[model samples]
Target: MVAKGKVGILTTNYYNPDGNRIIYGGAERYGLELTKLLLELEYEVAWWQVGTGWQKEMLPGVPLYSIPETGDNFQTCPRLNQSFYEQAVQVDFAIYFVTFLAYPQVLEKSISISHGIFWDYPSFDAVIPTEELRRERLRRLWLAFNGPRKIVSVDTATIQWATTTWPGLWHKFEYIPNFVDLNLFSPSEQERKDGKIRVLFPRRLTSVRGINEAARAAEILTKKYDNLEFHFVGRAHDDNLEKEMVRWSAKHPNIYYYWKAPQDMPHVYQNVDIVLIPSKSTEGTSLSCLEAMAAGCAVITSYVGGLPNLIIDDYNGLLIRPTAANLTAAIEELAFNHDLRKRLGQKAREVAANFGLEKWKRSWAKVIGEVFK
Candidate 1:
């Protein structure tokens, strides 16, 4: 097949810059899917990221360039953006893997992606730290917004927040939620009948993803119920945090901590009866929540970001304020009430049918088609 044109994607890191190991997470998964979609559409793709000036392959024939640009004052990495802009001159189009990376400058035929509102947490104030810095940040963000032909937002929360922040930028946004592989992540043919109830927290072990709350709930609930098992199946940012989680899990008999690759997650979701997507802040239409829903597992997600968009309160899944107490109570309620769990899980699967991989690909195709045209 003939290629349409070369496309360059700029981001912080697609994989650990120092090594080939992928940082398995929602954003990375989104990037992978986007690249595949572009390839499927007969476009040549290359990826660029802040790295140690090394080159690798993101996929077969898709070059991953590492630009060794460092430090931007606003934490937006404009230097990397500039570096990619300068080096990727041959590319006909560009995709900013992160929305902020398009700031300072962007190519003429380009688009950006907003994962969700990452600064919703209170401590993010320390990043900007002053009114002048905050204003400067907003200014750069506005410039970033202006540069992208269209900003594909993973959730409406980001669009709502962005439009509220800059009242007239609505037309530049595209709402495309994350997707689930319905065929792969469907319910187990026969539900586990061993009488053991498993609750899985299948997210990266980060503070923003409510790892602390999940840990507290696991500690409290595992001690309370004999049939309950709490599984924390994700890697932390560093080896130290991973060790910490393993050590913590060792102290509790019914608690298990392990990490799985992206390909293995569907089986993990199917085995578990309940899934916890208790994100405290900084979330999108979570991939974990959708996968769990597709697997016909009862889901408990916090009422933050795009979770509310996917789950109706007490309808498809349990939506609560992402606290240790709330998570414990929700888990306990579902554990005891098997019928409620079954109903919620079944409805969640039905709802998840709407967000299938094909629908996501079609939505993205429309956006990319427009950009290429």
Candidate 2:
């Protein structure tokens, strides 16, 4: 067992120069929150950034280091060389935010916290859906084979997915739900002025996330409830899918599209009546759903991946199949009944409390304590 001492976090930094304080992405936000939790537990913490162009100004009071971007051959990269190993050796343990298992030297004393599996899943944006990409993906599997001393997943479904995809790795697995800052996403007492029922969809406009399905649902729902408004927030120029969404928005006035500005999320959630997550791909316990629940917004999502575990249908929130008809039905049900929305929102808040900052701190402390013991 590794001795208990200061812990180092190896993660990608998300400091943008646009003056946004809060990072919206799940993995980046998770790493930051984990660092805060470790600090609260009285464990000295340090950050090792793997990529370049990260702003240091936002990361005040935290000791930081940067790793130069390695080309295709990451083995020869200085970031993966002996110097990097020597620097990380100072810490008692290292927690990798994602799968960087190609460098086994670092994995010797490291724990892996993965958002998703590295090999089995195919990139949704890749143009070549051929055998070449499949073989390349197979080659990447070797990196994960080296793996980490300990593996942490965000939810039971994630753990199960990982184990099912790769057998004989269950013994090293542990479940630790994602933590969120409840203070930032609190319920507002101010009445929503807009007569239209506002629905927020905060996801990348891509096929994997089922954004097309969301748009289709909006098209169907608009026929019945003309006052309904659908707002999508994410990268606008990243893909052609977003361009298609923009075109759809132009045709329909009720549909709105906003480029994701990190600081504006809390305000966005505050104004919306419900949050929708209609992902068709594998999800690693969505942070967007958790944030919406914390903000006292009724969540309507598909019963896929870790979503079902986070949201209990008709209890904390509503879970529907990944279909336009079902999604439209769920939205219609929530929009007509104000009391049901209030009850679901209250239950969601209660569930989110379990994943508060303090709870995560305690969980990390216990894990570190056990590892040292």
Candidate 3:
């Protein structure tokens, strides 16, 4: 069925479309894909970013719009002064990246998507928060999510967290995991040759994701074995982290950085033997993990968060503590043994086959379509 009204997606960061293609992490990917799905279903789609950044172009027929930044960028939340609240505003429904950024009563129908907890996982910090800030965040979260709209969590961890912490709001939340196109992400001919192995850090170059630590680990390993090369794909959300990555690449000939989107990550993953996801914080479910798995890369990730749920510690993939020593060891362990890497990757693909785009689309359509009813 064709959607009857325009749908707007509000995001925390001003997403640059033509620049990186897949700009933001999992949430942006979800929002972007959902926009495509809506357009396919004949809905008028409006892509709303908090500010007008580098995005001058949009996906063919979809027009992009910006919300006036309310002059408030408190930690991880974007507070817009006015959004979807004018006589000219034609969007009947809006899908928010997270509940905190949702415009109060701005759309005829509003659906909150719980991708990841921004406060819990700040783009800048690799450290713990102050108690005062934590309390303030909690207050804002209650103000945001303690409303009537249907909320969609990207994974089960989010539902469990919300139910335990927020209690009464459990009835409103829905679990919808991240997905990958199986056809788009699969194995390719091994790119490793001449005793050289490629290890890829696919997440944004953020300290929280352990880019610095990973770089240090890679540098140390390169000193021991010259054929060990490291490649980082995707741009940084944090400037310092980006600079650090560039500097590290300069310092270590074995480490390399791609400032822009490679655009085709499946090919990128397939070309590499290892995929690293050393996140300091939790995710509902990691899209990086799922995608890399589908591409048949030997997956190595932190034991924290939903990673343990996806990886079985050398069963399907390898899981380690998010530390330089641990991550370095995991990479080295997989690199030295080709058979283990192949076995883990094959099993990883088998596991990832369950999370395809078709399943995700049907579930998301049902949840979003429920809003109109």
Candidate 4:
């Protein structure tokens, strides 16, 4: 059990619930869930919301402090208020969720859980493509360098990437897999008897995510197979991509689009026959892929980042190249073979059971215990 001491959770934004906003990503969700778990373990929890409109819909009964009238972007100036620092210092441990701005304030015994390595590599600059944004990234990197405590990555693949890129930080690193709520995402017994094979593509419509490839694959498959339907869920990044995706939807009647709500995801999974994650970039361990697997959806994803670690190809899920042709082929193969889909879906469920909330709780408890000790 966690001792009775104040624990502050630092995150980007906590208002937007799961499956709502893509920018408010999985790290924020994990932070909130981790905070809840820590509270349930009997710890005094305090959250510091740096952005406006973030404190409105926080979990009920949780104490949250909003930084007073600072600039809209608190990440740029995280130390604007001295009172926030004083309150944070009073806590036994501070947990920062991938916030580079909070790095300067992190003291001894503080733990930093990074969802992605934004500063140490050049791939991040591509996402933020502006001179001002690049400057901000550099400033954050400078702050992170002079931070009080060392940061720890959440996954082994991230650790390896960090070690390979910036050597001599191996001692400060540890791997903790991202936690998933098993009860919410567990497989349903209701069999999908729909004649059409429903394929789900639940990923942000970003360049790195390769949503265009998925859309193209859908277009190709729709031309070849009549009984195959493609479903896309999640927010689009830019107006152009959204317009193109919407155009694709108009062109193909079998293609369906939905902006999924968190509460509606379980029911959504029941209708999906297969899940596709055709990410071209080095995707971190994707929660959507895991959630799909947990819901007994046959997963077909590119072998990137920690995907290879989670999905044992042909055992739990299928790993295809990040190309439209390959993805289309995989889809066609699965569409024709119902038994293969069932077997893969069942195995995926078993693999997902290992990543349940209970397992994550135990792992986190051990990490916190060791860190505090």
Best by lDDT: 1
Point out where model 4 deviates above 4 Å.
1-3, 15-24, 49-54, 63-90, 99-102, 117-152, 165-167, 237-251
Sort all candidates by TM-score, best to worst.
1, 3, 4, 2
TM-scores, one per candidate? 0.98, 0.77, 0.87, 0.80
Local distance difference test values of all predictions, in order: 0.91, 0.70, 0.74, 0.71
Better of 3 and 4 by lDDT: 3
Better of 3 and 4 by TM-score: 3
**What does the lDDT come to for candidate 4?**
0.71
- Prediction 2 global C-alpha lDDT: 0.70
Per-residue lDDT of model 1, residues 169-225, tens digit only: 999999999999898899999868898999999999999999999999988888888
Displacement of residue 97 (Cα, Å) in model 2 is 0.9
Q: Specify the highest-TM-score model's number.
A: 1
- What 10-residue stretch in candidate 4 is worst by lDDT? 15-24
Better of 1 and 2 by TM-score: 1
Query: Which pairs of residues have clashing backbones in candidate 1?
Result: none
Off by over 4 Å in 3: 1-3, 16-24, 52-57, 73-81, 103-108, 121-136, 189-193, 238-244, 259-262
